[model samples]
Target: MKGLIFVELMNFMEEQFGELLTDEVVDAAAIPGDAAFTTIGQYPSAYASRLIGAAADRSNASAAELCRAFGRYLFCRFEVRFPTMIQRYPSARSLLMHVEAHIHEEVRIIYPDARPPTVTALEVDDALHVVYRSDRPFAHIAYGLVDQCIASYGEQSTVEWCEGNDDSHARFIIRSLHRSAA
Candidate 1:
């Protein structure tokens, strides 16, 4: 995984849990490179899982839930750092459709070693259906990103998650409805 991810995770921990808890999580994680993360550096993904597990224990939340929340928070951070990426798409569905084709391609250009998840979208019964596949299990995080994307568009949306037969793959159905219409 990219060190930028760890850096952002640390930022999320501090902002959401507090400085003391964030420090505790990082210190307890026993991460390689002593948590001196550089945005361009790469680290083992297991270290990230450890940090998330520690944060989950401290917060009394499931690791999956925390990961998803972190994803949502990360989206806000991304918006701040890369406004053009989010601004170019008028809808969450549109953004999702281009995640693999556009966003991940840009990521590859910036950090050639980064292994972003594969995201594909299809339309079904007026809902945006997305399938997420990766060797690393971060479906909850993807869910959070989708949730925030809908919110960013000022749309009311419901995201349903379905675990794939393979542990590393997952599917999401996002249905957006107008706030007033609902």
Candidate 2:
């Protein structure tokens, strides 16, 4: 995983929870790297899992919920850090569609060893269908990203997600809703 993610997760914990809780989570994680992280460095993805698990244990929140919240924060971080990458898209659907081919590709070019999820988006009936396949089971996080993406466009959307036959895959179907004529 990218250290940037770990750094963001730590920041999320510190700000949302507290500095002491952040240290506790890191300590409970007991992973190799501990809490040391550099934005441009890489570490085992499992460390992130442990950090989230530790936070879940302390906060009495499900790991999925925590991951989803982190996803929302992650999207906001991207908006501030990489405005051009996201601002180029006119709609949430457009951004989701290009993630695998464009965004991940760029990540690979910049960090050759980085392993990111493979996302593919298609339109089915009236909804945008997205399939996310990755070794890491973090679809809840993806769901949050999709939710915030639509919100960022000032559009109302509902997302339904289902796990694949296995943990390595997930499908997200998002339907745009008509806002009331207020």
Candidate 3:
């Protein structure tokens, strides 16, 4: 977890979720990212801040351990209210329970503050419509992944190439993925 992410998430609470938040909860939530932030992940700083918040509470419990416990609690079930998550994940705590993705450095720069869209489904037609935006680029890299995920999971589906979007995404379909224009 990053201080930036925690702060940004906190700021987003007011802006997007219409809620007041505490630093302690955010701090307790930052441990899982400690091992591979820059090399393999993007939220180390935020995790660190979360740990600091956790550490402040108990002398017997380390922030890391507290965070581990928090992680367990998060996955078990808690009400975390965030307005923008479409009512599925009600808060940051709840969002933490469900969403898990590795950020792409290329797109992360443009939407660094944003979390990747989790793919509940991929509806592919002339365009690649992803249930989770983070799963969008995979539409090009391997349509089979989308096919397997959605069809196997019973989502309406197809895999076809589209044009536009600064070529950031479409280019992948054409250049590396051998996708034909629709």
Candidate 4:
């Protein structure tokens, strides 16, 4: 993780946890009650806290390398129904599988040319799941995901639409809602 993200994490922890960190900050913040649960701290249990919310070197590090790092992190966290298809891009795509319908569309709106997931009844979970990268040009997706979800749904949704690129290569699920009976 970059020094900035580490520092920001510290400040974020203090703001959310009601106190600044110290020797026991790790334990106190990592506890189930801390606001850290809402941030990158959620992944520390799996050793992913090292790389969850930092920028790769614009100096030398490539996006693919960063995506791979993120992939490794998420693959260890989420239980994928289609692991093979998703195993390739855990950091970038897998986290998107559980998004709610309308919020997913709002996330797409964040990207100018981005589209939402094609809606499907599927085996279960009729909700929409869209993948919009969070960093780079698509960084606005993060702003959209959080803002729109709060606007359309409520302030309680924890779903995040963050990724590692700016250019829009968005994927969405578009399905019509109607009555179908035998």
Candidate 5:
């Protein structure tokens, strides 16, 4: 994982939970180098899992839930950091459809060592089907990102997690709801 992710996670923890809780969580996780992260560096992915686990234990929230929330928060940060990439798409579905071929490609160009997940979106029966594949067990975070993306586009949609063959795979079905005249 890239250090940028760690830095963002730290920022998310501090902003949402507070500096005290963030410190406690980091201390509990016992990440190497005392949790000091540089945006351009790379670290063990396990550090991220441990931090999330510690935060979950302290906050009384499930790890999956925490990951999802973090994903949503992360998306907002991405929007602020990469406005041009986000602005190119008019809707969440549009952005998702090109995540793998475009966005992730751009990410790889900027952060050569970054290992991002494979996100592919397909349109079927008027709904968007997003497939997420990664060695890391962070599908819930992807779900959260998709959820927030839809909401950010001012679109009415429900995101559902479909079955996956294993931990490394997940499918999300996003269906837009059409509202009738009042």
Candidate 6:
């Protein structure tokens, strides 16, 4: 994982749970190197999982829920950080359709060591079928990101987790409610 992710996670925790709880969670997670992550630094993915687990243990929300929420928050942060990348697409559907070919490719170019998930979108009739595949177990995060992306685009859509072969593989079906009703 990249340090930017960890740094953003800390910011998300502080914003959502306050500084005290965030400090406690970080302390409990016991991440190496004082938990001071730089944007360009590389860290173990396990550290992120451990932090999420510790947060779940302290809070009422489950790890999956927290991951999803984090994803939502992360999307906003990404919008701020990479405005040009997002501005190229007029709608969330278009952005998602090119996530693998465009966005992730840009990420790889910027961060050669970063291992991002493969997000593939297929347009089927009135719905878009999105497939998420990754070595890390963060499909719930992807679900939340998709949810927020649609909402951010001012689109009325419903996203359903159609199936999951494993933690590494998940599929989501997104259909515009207005279009469907029409």
**Candidate topping lDDT:** 6
User: How high is the CA lDDT of each candidate model?
Assistant: 0.83, 0.84, 0.34, 0.34, 0.88, 0.90
Order of quality (TM-score): 6, 5, 2, 1, 3, 4
Candidate 5 global TM-score: 0.94
Q: Deviation in angstroms for 158 in model 1?
A: 0.5
Q: Which lDDT value does model 6 have at 128?
A: 98
Backbone clashes, each candidate: 0, 0, 19, 15, 0, 0
Show the lowest summed lDDT stretch of 10 residues, model 6: 161-170
lDDT against true structure, model 5:
0.88
Worst 10 residues of 5 by lDDT: 173-182
Error of 3 at 128 (Å): 28
Per-candidate TM-score against the hidden true structure: 0.92, 0.92, 0.24, 0.23, 0.94, 0.96
- The alpha-carbon deviation from the true structure for residue 131 of candidate 1, after best TM-score superposition, in angstroms, is 1.0
List ranges where model 1 is wrong by over 4 Å. Answer: 163-167, 179-182
lDDT of 2 at 39: 88
Q: Please provide, for model 5 over 1-182, each residue's C-alpha lDDT reduced to its tens digit, 9 standing for 90 to 100.
A: 98888899999889879999999998999987889999888998889999999999998788889988999998998899899999999989889999999999999998888889999999887778999999898888898899989888988888988865344689999887772221
List the candidate 3 regions with Cα displacement exceeding 4 Å. Answer: 1-5, 8-58, 69-81, 89-110, 113-182
Question: What is the TM-score of candidate 6?
Answer: 0.96
Error of 5 at 47 (Å): 0.7
Worst 10 residues of 3 by lDDT: 167-176
Residue 116 displacement in candidate 5 (angstroms): 1.1
Evaluate residue 93 in candidate 1 and report its C-alpha lDDT on the 0 to 100 scale.
80
Q: How would you encode candidate 3's per-residue C-alpha lDDT over 1-182 as one tens digit per residue?
A: 22333443344323422342333344355445322234233553434444334443533554433333333332222123222332453322223233333222323464556444343322234333433233223222123333332332233434444455321132112121223332
Clashing pairs in 6: none
Candidate with better TM-score, 1 vs 3: 1
